[model samples]
Target: MRADAKKNYGRILEVARTVIAEHGSDASMRDIARRADVGLATLLRHFPTREAMFEALLCTNLDALTQKAVALESSNPPDVALRSWIREWVEFARSYRGVVTMMAAAHTNPASALYASCAAVHSTSARLLSNAQAEGTARPDMNGDDLFALMTALGWAVDQPSFAPRADHLVHLITSTVLLGRVG
Candidate 1:
């Protein structure tokens, strides 16, 4: 990419992050272009679709979360590592507003722009859950899909105004009762 083109791309991504933070995953591409001081054509040239833009924006953070899960798997106890990673995943999902819905959809759609990243996160989460279950710390009946669904549901709940205040408590309750098979 040329220097000016690369600069515009970076600027658009930066502005899109801000706009999406304020408005959510459904934030308008035109608004992002306006905020970035770039023409709509320029933004579209860089990101051909909304999913492409979101995939670019979220890739780094999702990769970081996967890496964190990997590290925790090696360094912490099975239950502790799984619980910690779940907390972090919920926080990441909440930060992006409506991202949990996209993630849930992307998890099953191979053609989605977010498919690879979401798959990586899901696989890592499954591994963490498997480790915990093997150690008798987590419920044996729960699989990776179950865990992923729970995380997304919790993420969605916490994003709501009515549930935001109880976020921490909900996390604790889910981790203890649903994942750990203990009373929360």
Candidate 2:
């Protein structure tokens, strides 16, 4: 890209992070363009779609989480690693409002820009869950898909005003259930 275009792209991304943080996944592209002082056409030329913009916005963090999962897997016990990763995943999913819905959709849509990142997360989650189950720390009946669903569900819950106050408790409850194989 040309220097000016690269600068515009960076600016757009910077503004997008703030807008998304404020308005969430449904944040308007026009608003981002306005905030970045770029024309709508320029923003569209750079991103083309909301998914493409979000892919750029979230790719770095997703990669970090994937790497974190690997590190946790090696440095911690299987149960600890799985629990830690799940908590991180929930936090990521909740970073932008309405993101959990996008994530759930992206998980099943290979054509989506987020598919690769979500798939990497799911793969890592499966490995972590498998390790825990093998060590009798997690339930044998659970799978990576189940864990992914739980993460999204918890993320969705915590995103709501009613559940936001109990975020920590909810995370602990879910992690305990995953680790102990029982609700109580």
Candidate 2, run of 10 with poorest lDDT: 175-184
lDDT of 2 by residue, 1-184 (tens): 9999999999999999999989988899999999999999999999999999998998998999999999999998898899889888878867778878888899889999999988998899899999999989998888999998888899999988899889889999888878875322
Name the regions of candidate 2 deviating beyond 4 angstroms.
Answer: 181-184
Q: How many residue-pair clashes does candidate 2 contain?
A: 0
Q: What TM-score should be assigned to candidate 1?
A: 0.96
Write out the backbone clash pairs for model 2: none
How much is the lDDT of residue 150 in candidate 1? 91
Global lDDT scores for all candidate models? 0.91, 0.90
- Model 1 vs truth, CA RMSD: 1.4
